[model samples]
Target: MYYNCGVGGYISGIAKDKKTKLTTAMATIGGAGLDWHDVKSYLRPNGLLSYSTLNDGSNKLIFNNYPGGKVFDAVVLQDNSQGPIHPELKKFFEKYAAIHSKDIRATGAEPVFLMTWAYADRPEMTKQLADATIKVANDNKAMVIPVGLAFANALKDRPDLKMTVADNRHPTAAGSYLEGAVIYAALTHSSPEGANFLGGCEKPLAQKDAQFLQSIAWKTVKDFYGWK
Candidate 1:
């Protein structure tokens, strides 16, 4: 099974980009519960499958929401935090280990990947999040992906590259393209095809023509999944 889950606010951006048509069927499907633990009983009996989501926040937020649940895998994340790892976060993961230990003893094996996506406030901040993420992942034996750092590397040379700033933080059209690449990278563990996706949005300076950003956007997703 393929389970998609995340906080409502984070998934809204993806729905807007991937299925802009608000009335479409997809608008309602393909996401997991924001608080996975809260819905554990509903998910446990379902069995093994692929999972994805932007379920990032305080560990307590996750713990309170999820109690003794297991995922085949996960990409836990939090938005921008300018400082070093928040003390609360460290505490939460420690507690997560305790809860997970109990769950693992009962349930066998499950994989977890701790992730974070946020623009760093300064150059050194990336290192801080990296170190913190590594430490937590080590303690919990979870995979770690520092998406914000990855974006910084991807965009370093392309100064023109920028996230679409709608209400200031949410991705714009171009921003969504960047986000797609990030997600692609997270899934594939590779430098995903980034430029190809952005090409669809270029404004035609000449003849009267039509362009559809969604086509490129969707292709990016398809190609990343090796579906086309």
Candidate 2:
């Protein structure tokens, strides 16, 4: 289960196409301003691991409408970009995260939190969001993907990289690719440094740039988890 906004959509796009160590079957339900509250509405009434589709013509990827009573191994939860950091929304973010973590555990699936990046223009948000996300994940004893940390590391290493669209919030192709790579590294506990998936970017990334993003992703994940 992958649920959130455009970031989750882009990650699902990579999972749908990328050939990695893990064979993934992802169901992505996304829309703008999608928070945990919105996710709660879509939870299966039967208390299954599946969710009803919220197809408002905004979702980039929608797969496996019904899990057919099949349980998911893990469910990725991403709140709105500001949900973790915003004062008013942060409470709901924490509350629903706890609720959903327990709900997901009840379904025999681990709850994984997707730590999203801050808006491109607001670089300071990186640490703020990371802190908030880590707190919640620690509270639930859940896994944190650390995608936000990957984004911050990428920008710090290469300030010239165009990570976001003109809106400075939505990710560009390169940014999306980085997100996927970080996720891959975190989930598989392996480096994505040499995998040849370009994340379906409109224009293929240069080999050098792709490798750079992959390295950054692997490094970030390794550091976040204190992995060797």
Candidate 3:
């Protein structure tokens, strides 16, 4: 039931808490750039709560749209300058988890899992970031949802599905949907009808898009759990 307390509020209204059966525990990544202040606003006055990636670093990375470095081989800054594996990033996610934990506990709901999706320029860098990111999540014993692999897979076939106008790295509306699909699948433990639901959710992406997304998503999930 945790959320990013930003655009994630939009996802609050999908279907009453029948499946999850609980009010959401919201969390914002970096606690910045949120369109709304709290779950109430993010979910809108009328929307019921489900889940969304309002504040995870992966989503923040997507929002920042930081390009991958040529030498680093990753999109996000993972060097010592950024304090790779330092307390700052850990603290950021820690504070995030603490807040959501408090919120969920107060609401008497059991914490489920956490979702993240980052866009890096290369596979090697993505693995590095994923390693560090996974460490942080595992240290806290929270389920970490991998959305990057999903994004990468979603684009395998649809080479035209660029997230940014020039970079093809940041997530576009379609990319966001791909992220949502991954998170949705994790929370529900059931796959959606389509891998990447585009066209205002009325029509699924072409078969190529679905396969591409599915390909990466499956791999990401596999890596997350060491399914291989």
Highest TM-score against the true fold, candidate: 2
For residue 205, model 3's alpha carbon misses the true position, in angstroms, by 3.8
Candidate 3's C-alpha runs over 4 A off are 1-90, 110-125, 155-160, 165-169, 193-204, 226-228
153 Cα displacement, candidate 2 (Å): 0.9
Q: Give RMSD to native, each candidate.
A: 11.7, 5.7, 12.9
In order of appearance, the predictions have TM-scores of 0.47, 0.77, 0.52
Worst 10 residues of 3 by lDDT: 69-78
lDDT of 1 at 161: 48
lDDT of 1 by residue, 2-90 (tens): 11122222223333444332211011222222222422332352432222333565333211232355442333333234223556455
Winner on TM-score between 1 and 3 is: 3
Ranking by lDDT: 2, 3, 1
lDDT of 3 by residue, 39-102 (tens): 2223222232322355656763222221231111101111221122345555554444544434
**Candidate 2: where is the Cα deviation over 4 Å?**
1-70
Pairs clashing within candidate 1 = 4-31, 4-32, 5-32, 37-66, 38-65, 56-77, 164-172
Which window of 10 residues has the lowest lDDT sum in candidate 2? 1-10
Candidate 2, position 114, lDDT: 87
lDDT of 1 at 94: 48
Candidate 2 lDDT, 84-184, residue by residue in tens: 88888888888888888887777566889989998988889999999999999999999999998898999999989888889898777788778878877
Candidate order (TM-score): 2, 3, 1
Q: What is the C-alpha lDDT of each candidate?
A: 0.38, 0.72, 0.42
